[model samples]
Target: MSRAGRLGVGIIGAGKVGPVIGAALAGAGHALTGITAGVDEERVQAILPGIPVLDALEVVRRSELVVVAVPRDELPGLVTGLAEVGAWQPGQLVLHTDASFGTGVLAPAAASGAIPLAVHPAIAFTGTSMDLRQLSNAYAAVTAPAAVLPIAQALAVELGCEPVVIAESDRLAYAEAIAISTEFSRSIVAQAAELLRGAGVPHPGSYLSALVHSTVDHALSQAGSAGAGPPAEALEG
Candidate 1:
């Protein structure tokens, strides 16, 4: 912790998620120590201007809380490789934002006595300040050792999300639900836009935007109603 209870937060992976996480933490009064450079430097700077671009080791060395927002596939190797280099500091808070993983993926860091946490925000990030607004409506799935569970939940709340406790054993199922919702919405929208374009619509995206939003809103409302579930009968062609 820094002066007056503020943590020195460092972020690895300057991709879509990292900078946004840094920004959110900064908004919550945590000072950003620095962020790793290499991905989208422009977006990183835009989201967190004036924060130094440091190497991963230096970032780890300086931070009291480290945020790892790298891609799902790269997370294990990054944690393990950092462990190999002896980078994890004892007693430091280490959190990753990958839905597919729980703290088990951070065993290497935990072995060095670092506290491991998984707090995956449920949102499709645009890698911009716009995401900050969306965070208020988001739910973060938090998993951590029972002793440190409150820390994870508090951090998630600080990031403007409601915290939902997900057991480490259930991470895969939680991840599948997130992926399915995101991909299905994206695919349906793209297909609709393409069909409109083929039919000579000048701006299919603009044309469908309101309709899509209202339709989805209606469907969600229905799903939330008493005794609601999937339709019993299939639609006729």
Candidate 2:
């Protein structure tokens, strides 16, 4: 596809990540051809009101850019299944949002002439419009071959993310680090909220939300200034 043109995009999953990212790409002028969601139809529709909801094969056949946002474990099977059915088209762009596996997992589709890309946004998604604003400050870990790296980066930028190239060999370790930090942060916030509620504070979670946001923003700013150095304290348990 030409750099100036918008591709016809289809989403293979309508879970938390898919609809939001599909919406972001739609906002970037891409035509949202269809989306597939087995259980979260209502939530998906709420996130992508006018987009058509179709089956996975139909989605793949109709789109120039197919985004596979299923869970990490299901990704490889889905890609291979699609390839086996000859769903992937020549010069098609295939992207996945899973942080654990890079484009290597999309080898089945790539062998069929699809351009595989792994572009993961390093932010928690709420499957709501609120997530859109979060995209501006979020960083996306992008893994693609050198020849198509610019295309991945461009898509990330269009979605309001700063794209960082992640080596395929380092993808799993990178995902683990993100999981450790984000999951631990959530646990800490939940514990704090529980303690506040025990002390007779109503809406403890609501009260703690702003403080957590501010603290995280400050920490990220500090980390950026420190040039990606390891944190003084380990977050992992």
Candidate 3:
């Protein structure tokens, strides 16, 4: 970490989420030391142009903050494997972006004196620059040891996101909610688009885009209000 509090950040994956996140942190003045390309060389170049592509262990060894943005299944093994190799450094901040887990999966790294954190940005990623813009509108679910909880929240803020504290125990519930919403919305959109196409609409997705956005926005705006939805009669019709 620099005296200015900007970290030398390294990323473990260059998949859909990693490079975009590195770009976000870079935007906040953190130095992106390196990233693992993982077959996403094109994406890494596109989003984080000029960042060095290094292996996972090299990335961890080189940085004060390491961001692990691999798939959920891969995270535990990767962290443990890194620990087994003695790659984790004392006082280093190690964070993973998987919504399904909190800091628990990072126990191995923590054992090596690493400070573990979990910060999941609540949005679908396209592995593109558009994700950087979306970060401003998204909330990040942050889980970390209470002593360093603010660090996790600050990192989320640095990514242009509002930070919401999520308890370690509730990480799975949070993941479930995210999964349900995204899957349901995607299924609905696909069905709607199919129906529209069947009805001879030339561009079903484009036609429904505005309507879907407005409807979801309205629903979310009304989400916190009790009895805020349509009346029984409205549903019946």
TM-score per candidate, chains pooled: 0.92, 0.90, 0.93
Ten-residue region with minimum lDDT total, candidate 2:
228-237
What TM-score should be assigned to candidate 3?
0.93
Model 1 ranges off by over 4 Å: 1-3, 226-237
lDDT over C-alpha atoms for residue 215 of model 3: 98
Measured with C-alpha atoms, the lDDT of residue 136 in candidate 1 is 93
Q: What is the TM-score ranking, best to worst?
A: 3, 1, 2
Instruction: List per-prediction Cα lDDT, in the order shown.
Output: 0.90, 0.89, 0.91
CA lDDT of 123 in candidate 2?
A: 84
Cα displacement (angstroms), candidate 2, residue 14, comes to 0.8
**Residue 169, candidate 3: alpha-carbon lDDT:** 92
Q: Per-residue lDDT for 163 in model 1? A: 83
Distance (Å) between predicted and true CA of 217, model 2?
A: 3.3
Q: Taking the tens digit of each residue's C-alpha lDDT, what string does model 2 give over 43-162? A: 888889978989999999999999999988899999999899999998999999999998999999999999999999888998888899999888888889989988998888887888
Per-residue lDDT for 123-221 in model 1, tens only? 999899999999999878899999998889889988998888888899999899989989999999999999999999999999999999999989878
Leading candidate by TM-score:
3
- Candidate 3 per-residue lDDT, tens place, 41-107, comes to 8778988989998999999999999999999899999999999999999999999999999999999
In model 2, residue pairs whose N, Cα or C atoms come closer than 3 Å (at least 3 residues apart or on different chains), thus clashing, are none
State which candidate, 1 or 2, has the greater TM-score: 1
